[model samples]
Target: MARRRRKSRGRKLILAVAALCLAAVYPLQEQLTDGGGDSRGAGNAAAEDVSAAASDVFRDGSTLEVHFLDVGQGDATLIRCGEAAMLIDAGNNSWGDDVRDYLEYQSIGDLDYVIGTHPDADHIGGLDVVMEAFDCGTVIMPDYEKDTQTYTDVTDVMEEKGYELTLPQVGMVYELGEAAFTIVAPNGEYGDNANDYSVGILLEHGENRFLLTGDAEEDSEADMLDNGIDLSADVLKAAHHGSRTANTEAFLERVNPEYVVISCGEGNSYGHPHAEVLNRLREMGIKVFRTDEEGTVVATSDGAGITFNVPPSESWQAGEPKG
Candidate 1:
């Protein structure tokens, strides 16, 4: 009778241990499901690994700073998050010194990412100078190349600096400190036009977003919209300096940006910031900032909201939208 009682107690202990083990595994199994209400054992390891890796990112108390340098009829934006810095374009050749000075003033020690957007002279003309002035980790550009001197100058610098040029592809994500940016345009071939092949970067800082498109026209914009890429942004860098060829009504409606930044020279021969685009922005009640009108536009974000160098009262007002 004593032996039988001992056996019963042992059985109860084993059952309790089994119950605890099962309880611990249940939550993990549910989290590792592969979506069809099925959780396979092999996927558990991968799921846990991914979760651990993501945990290291998006830590609390991170700030992002963006500087839209007034490179005069060209685009040059410097984004800095912690120790990482990214430069999108460097303006025209004539503006090389200015862009370099601005970077220096910002105390940018090195450039982690340098994006040319396209091979256009206005976009990348000063990049060679920038590369010469500072150490660059990666250089990104469109797949298409032009035979123009501007393109040659940029490539020459890349070769001289022993930097491998990366042609941006759609859906590629890059990290800048706690913030991240994704390439959302030039998904595929864009034929002959360099502007149409422009690279678009969607920068994300916590809940805030900024879209920068280097001279991308309607065709590229349409493709991005059709691909279901998130075109919505808090601030948008106007395409082609706010030309009529781009920024169609449909594109504007989809992006629905609260503010637009246009990079163009004052009294530029191209007549940028066209009346059509201005009127559309007005109708949407969106605020507009122009490099030509406001010098350099600097916006800082604390991962939740953004504050610009210039006040809202300084923003452009086109009065009314044409019927």
Candidate 2:
């Protein structure tokens, strides 16, 4: 009887060990199924990846000029400091050639940073063509991955171009010449809504600051406020194409921007630059420029003050002083 009991006890111990092994394997299996290997090391690995990929792109400088391209009905922003250049959100796929022409017009052959604020087609669709036309130093995007064709096209181009991609994390700062571009929102975990998941960037140069809000809605804006981030800026990119769902009055009070740019299409389906949002900005005494109305808006800063340049024939609207 004692011998039989010892054998049964040994068998139970073996079964317990087997169960533990399965439990360990299950997490790794889940990670693999999700895509690539476990993300346990993704955080640590991302820094190195970004450094390696972008090491060749940026150059030190003190002056910077950002062009909020007038890609009708979509968003496409370009940043240039000295010889380094960065492209953020390439508009819609139909605007691919237009984006390429704009880059060529600016003589931007090599891109230090190619940022897709989110996976939405209107924001990232033209990236495939841009990537094909110019050499990219590094591609930064939000953490969430969608299975859309635009996403696939962008990924395929990245693979084809041998470029490594890194997701923009909160507090991650990229120094470009004399300016510091920092990711200020969409930190930690992914938000429930895609618009709320938008990546927000704060570009600082000396005393000048520009806040780029990538369609981030009120929920994300609340998160930013709760975190006590310095939302004040000299210039603001109106969120969600200036939709009624974003740019709350409370959030605007914190930003208190001198100038605001709204990137939206002419007679868009969404009726962007909503009347309520416009009224709020107007109340704050902030100057507003819309791509639909103002061709391409360019804001140049020399560390202390900023100047606005609207396409010829277009007059400055509310806040801009007559030159």
Residue 316's lDDT in candidate 1: 53
Separately for all candidates shown, the number of backbone clashes (residues 3 or more apart, or on different chains) is 0, 3
lDDT of 1 by residue, 1-323 (tens): 11101111111211111111112222222323422121112233343444334224421238687777766678999998888899999888766666775566445799999999998888998888888788999789988989998788778777877999898889899999889999998766778878989999999998899999889999998888887688899999999998988998998999999888888877777778788998898889887777676556666677777766453323453322233
The CA lDDT at 12 in model 2 is: 21
Model 2 global lDDT (CA atoms, 0 to 1): 0.71
Evaluated against the true structure, the overall lDDT of model 1 is 0.73
List clashing residue pairs in candidate 1.
none
The CA lDDT at 148 in model 1 is 91
TM per prediction: 0.78, 0.76
Pairs with steric clashes in candidate 2? 61-177, 61-178, 73-265
